[model samples]
Target: MIPPSSCGVLVVGSGNAGFSAAISAAQSGAGSVLLIDKCPESWTGGNSYFTAGAYRIAHDGLASILPLVSNVSSEQAERIDLEPYTEADFARDMRTVCGGRSDPELSRVLVEDSGDAVRWLARNGVRFWLSFNRQAYEVDGRTKFWGGLCLRTPDGGKSLIADLQASAAQHGVTTSFSTALVDLRYQGSDGVVATVRCDDGRRHEITARAVILAAGGFEASPSLRSQYLGPGWDMAYVRGTPYNTGDVLELAVRSLGAQTFGNWSSCHSVAWDASASTDPNAGDREASNEYTKSGYPLGLMLNAEGQRFVDEGVDLRNYTYAKFGRAILSQPGHLAFQVWDSQTSGMLRAEEYRPERAEHITGRTIEELAKACADKGLLDAEAFVRTVHEYNEAVYAHRRENPSARFDPSMKDGLSTQSSGKRLSLAKSNWALPLDQGPFLAVKVTCGVTFTFGGLRVDPQTAQLLSPGGGKIPRVYCCGEMLGGLFYGNYPGGSGLTSGTVFGRRAGRAAAAAAAAVEEEGDLVRS
Candidate 1:
């Protein structure tokens, strides 16, 4: 409930990045910081509230990260086989996933500052735990954490928002919900003036010495999706907040001449429940990220035509899941079915695959499963069964040649269909175990867009929005999904939240310093 008058720093959006900037600004002695969001207080955290809150950081194995988490017991720690994730490893993933097009400067900052940013978040109020359920596998009574992702907020993004909000309030930052930023302009010596519309339809202008925009991308806007992300994207279900319609981002570019960067045609999408609500505004708040069916890496995905459209085991789930949504969308009906035998059904994450959270179809045999999938809109029942049989045959042939090869999800075991003399048009690169075990489970999925990869370009060091002319915009900073060029085609799991924290902290500090400098200049004039 702040008056539409003046403040030292103004922040748009109330998600993790916004709160990170607000709290950082307040802590840095920026007086009268105000945070505003277009949605009501119920929709406070924006898309961040729907995330797994995973943070990927470079560390020295279990010993380096053990101090930052609260979930690992002394006995549990001893049995954990955690490997160190260095900056080089992180950078290599960024390059490989993005096809070597990720901005080197932004990637460097995100990787180098990730550890310190995570530690800073811990120093504030955010709590982290080992991502045991999502990133580890138990082999021989020992937990082996795979994929460089190890830490996540307990209970996922909900707890992340709660902790960040608490920290912001403690730091004297005020929040105003249902306050949408309509326009932004720099007034030179008078600072940045933002025109905002309140829920009551009242419009007013607020002046701030420095302004930070962290309002997220335009993934929720169907028009923008169809326009930028290409055809059929308008039908993609949104996995996060519908309120992030790119209002502030558009405002920045239109009014401030902010430079746009990165791949507008790609986004952080995933395999989502086909039964989930299609209405962008109607995302199940309780279900949140649980709608994601990421168990494909452990099994196979067939399109409506009953053909394998992707190499499900091409890489770890962290590396492949983001781009697979586009693959799923390109299929016949923009839908696919993930099938797993009894052998790997238990490996699926309970939070995502529990019957209460997701719809599951089971059958006693491959033929029965195919029939059931046909009932659920599969185009060809016979092809579905044939595909399964062919996959099983390939797996068996590979195993016969290389009996030493074993299916281990903890690492990229060389157990692949390609190892066999016979080959299918598409091959499972890893975790290729014959799916001949008893009853099988299948889940229907479609594309659920998480966020856009394209956004305003910002300086990697200060997070200040880069003007089209190749300079920083005066006193304006940007972070989170609104600042682009770090991710292009795909991103490693858990890097989004870490990148947000890194640049959010940078933008906050830079905005606060700008505000202080403005105040000092005014003080000198008065003196």
Candidate 2:
């Protein structure tokens, strides 16, 4: 437990950005750097612990064989690409996705140093996926391992979070969890923080030299959501734990005259929650058409009104799938059922939970499975049968009338969730499970936000926090989503891991340099 009067480079939140900031601040040479979060060490701090850890680096080291997507003269890709993609094309695609607000320098740093950043993790005693021993960025689809990080081995951010925590301990960085930040005290016009208040109904008045607001977004604050996102709207907070409360943002504004942005905006997330494994055919309903056409495509989605609003079968980024994720929260019971057809192709198989073993699957007579699910207490079976029939009529009518609709030709890709070779195509067939299938299945799903997207804003080059009037907040630095624009809100697939690593290092080295300077001057010297 940290004493009420403790001081140093104070860091808030224990998620990815917070961890990154704390470690970076400590290395920056700040004396007595402290890590504090709203939750105890026992529970997960926030969504970062459950992320996929996919960092997008445009080209996975293929600059040579292929011209850099930008200038033909560039070298092969990252030299480690297990999958095929060009850096230039990836950059173009991301810029296009960002609709132009992404900071160029930040993006450049992320794309350029992402590999080195992951390698740094390897240097920090973090576990590698290769312990079982196949290999890495040298391969294509994977990179630095998270070990038994936060969750199990497969997911990425969990390990990154775990690594940060362990590294903090090894470095002698002090941490106190389950403590809430209630206010921030600015020392002078330079915008330096002098102290912080806590929610233990007490205040922590210390002579802190710097502070990093790694406190996560307000996705969990129902009041904030109602005030900012929408009245009926709530975050997918239930998708994971609820440590994020916009505590820093709210506290900063309410107390220290801190300026904040992105409070009114909420990023896109996934809208399906597969509770109740009782539906024997549950696995099939999760892959969207993009997954069906590609491999591991996500399943179909429907709104509360039982109407398919999105393509229903496309892969990630077809349209900010995150926006549709909000659709999950808007549904009745904040849940909707993802249904699937009995496609004999083993291609749609999900290793997470195998559906191939269901002998009860029927290829026709759609409502039979609905009755079964209702009997199993998963849905109002009769209503489910009706919903399926309506979906079939819509599909048949659309195909007959507009067979040549907007779908891209490659949507028919015979393989991969990220498209086959070049562009990651979007597929809508995830919506095409004909009601004729007899043993159809449904799984309830809710909004699944990968992680909170908002936090502090930082200067591009220095990675330092900025004040409301729009100037750098001296002595205060932030990186990762804790800063801004790198993720650029909707996420470009793979940027999270990339941003965390890049920003983490920048903050670390900067913090280290700062600490060294402070010690030399005796300004932050020991009492």
Candidate 3:
């Protein structure tokens, strides 16, 4: 006789992924599924709680699923350029990311099931902004393209997690909040996840047939952040609360000896240091622009030897990609600068982008900006001035081309359009003034990123969690940023939500099936 001590399914997390798994397993007749979140009820991390909650699904491909949403505001959405990278193209990119180590079957599953994920959300009362840029994603089939809607649950919620939490309740899933899962225990079968322990020094024994870990990444854990992402970088989570501690990921890898991918990560460049010191309404994407040595865009980066590297005027994302992820007090260079002009000053003033108490480098001349830096103990004023003088001269002499001598037109535009300190074009400074404008501005900036591009390897089709041995980990699943090694390290917006839906569906289906199969064999609760 099976003891009453065991749950049919134990889900370790309360974020979107964990909630989805619990709800799916419960719906699939798991009898009972318990969700354990290490965080307090209001503060589950993993990017879901404070996420804009806008998901993207195919635009015209699945017109049938279009009518399911109850309410969506196309106007309220961030309508980005959806440049299409086709199914094949996406597969190729993913394959490269995984270094050709992914299962093709899983990839296909993710592509196919992703559509249904949107529909499932609709059926659960989630909504999406209907009017989308459908033609945008089809342009090149390799560029960042997506023609989809911005999704949210009804009544203007703050994030997708709230909607999911409420839905889990509606579906009768049990919740254990503020409970951290410290370890994973398996029964006789290594394939089966048997139990999870809470960090409260209490052992909540799990007699479940399956366990789903939706715990988040290492963004919030300072130690983990330094260990995985590199040191000396302050995590600027300007938005979401700090609660996720990577407990589940630790449980999976360190405890279970599982495999992981996507060791490389990026900070989204601007996003690493840009958030609400001021209202974003006025700051927008322009607030994080790079600065000239005269303070045009202020990212002045140096290497370990204190040698100046990268021109901040270059694409910020490039630095995030190539730089960052270094040791504390010992990165290639722990410092960078952001410089700007009068127009940038106006932008910051319009929104008070800089914190009211922060010291700023404002000058009618580069000498003054350097002096301001010295006043703040940032660097020697003389050396700083000379460095900028030399840099600008090089930029003026075609050492810095209109489009980076190394970057494509789209990449240049993509980067330039996003940064504010950098001129829209090096040639035009209001077509009237230049970085030489009196009262130039500069701000010492920090370079750090939140998550890496590497994560668990999976089969997207079945949403099957794979073992390091290249075999499926039975009764296991992954979604969200935990999806690693796909795309090799590059990311596209909306892809996270896309994977969540796609693999979430597969995980839900598979978990339910696992429960049912065990019941048929008289190994689990038949209910």
Query: lDDT winner among the candidates?
Result: 1
Runs in model 2 with CA error above 4 Å?
Answer: 3-8, 58-81, 84-86, 128-157, 187-201, 235-237, 254-258, 274-299, 317-321, 331-333, 344-364, 372-438, 449-454, 486-489, 515-527
Name the TM-score of candidate 2: 0.71
Expressed as tens digits, the lDDT of each residue in 382-430 for candidate 1 is 9999999999988888888998887899888877887537788899999
Write one digit per residue (lDDT tens) for candidate 2, span 66-127.
32122122233222233334556556655766666666777777767755665555566554
TM-score of every candidate: 0.99, 0.71, 0.68
| 1 against 3, candidate with superior TM-score | 1
- Which is better, 2 or 3, measured by lDDT? 2
- Rank by TM-score, descending? 1, 2, 3
Model 1 stretches astray by more than 4 angstroms:
278-281
lDDT for position 327 in model 1:
88
lDDT of 2: 0.51
CA-lDDT, candidates in order:
0.91, 0.51, 0.50
Q: Every model's Cα RMSD, please?
A: 1.0, 8.7, 8.2
Better of 1 and 2 by TM-score: 1
**Model 3 regions more than 4 Å off:** 1-5, 50-119, 127-157, 186-200, 219-246, 253-257, 264-271, 274-308, 311-333, 344-361, 390-434, 452-455, 487-490, 523-527
Model 3 lDDT, full chain set: 0.50
